[model samples]
Target: MAEVRAEMVANVWKVVVNEGDQVSDGDTLVILESMKMEIPVISEDDGVVAQLKVAEGDVIQEGDLIAVIE
Candidate 1:
């Protein structure tokens, strides 16, 4: 399993994948808004999304768990 974590504090602007969704490396799983910029959180490996730990409009801190892939 792989844990996808936030690299910076930001508000989750959009969730692009849901639980059980298949994703490839570099696929954007979520988009976060910070300092008026849109930052895309991407998958680091090819796998199925096992969990989603955040939602749109949620504020997340750096190192916070974003999703789990299996």
Candidate 2:
């Protein structure tokens, strides 16, 4: 299993995947807004999306666990 984590503190602007979804490397999993910039979080490995730990408008800190892929 692999964990997708926040690289910096930000507000979650969108979630682009759901549980059980098949994902590939480089798929955009979420979009976050910070300092007026839109930051896209992408999958680093091919896997099924096992869990989503945040939602739109949610605030996340650096290193926060955002999702699990397996």
Candidate 3:
């Protein structure tokens, strides 16, 4: 399993993948808003999305685990 973490502090602007979705290494999992910019959170390893720990509008800190892949 792999844990998807936030790269920086931001608000979850969108969730592009749902639980059970298959992903590739560079697949976009979520989009975050910070400093008026959108940032995409991507999977580090190919796997099925096992959990989504964040939602749209949720604020997250850097290094916070946002999703689980397995």
lDDT of 2 by residue, 1-64 (tens): 9999999999999999999999999999999999999999999999999999999999999999
Candidate with the larger lDDT of 1 and 2: 1
lDDT of 2: 0.96
Better of 1 and 3 by lDDT: 1
Q: List the residue pairs that clash in candidate 3.
A: none
Runs in model 3 lying further than 4 Å from the true structure = none
Model 3 Cα lDDT, one tens digit per residue, 1-70? 9998988999999999999999999999999999999999989899999999998999999999999999
lDDT of 1 by residue, 1-70 (tens): 9999999999999999999999999999999999999999999999999999999999999999999989
Off-target runs (Cα >4 Å) in candidate 1 are: none
Identify the superior model by TM-score, candidate 1 or candidate 3: 1
For each candidate, what TM-score against the reference?
Answer: 0.97, 0.97, 0.94
Candidate 1 C-alpha RMSD relative to the actual structure: 0.5
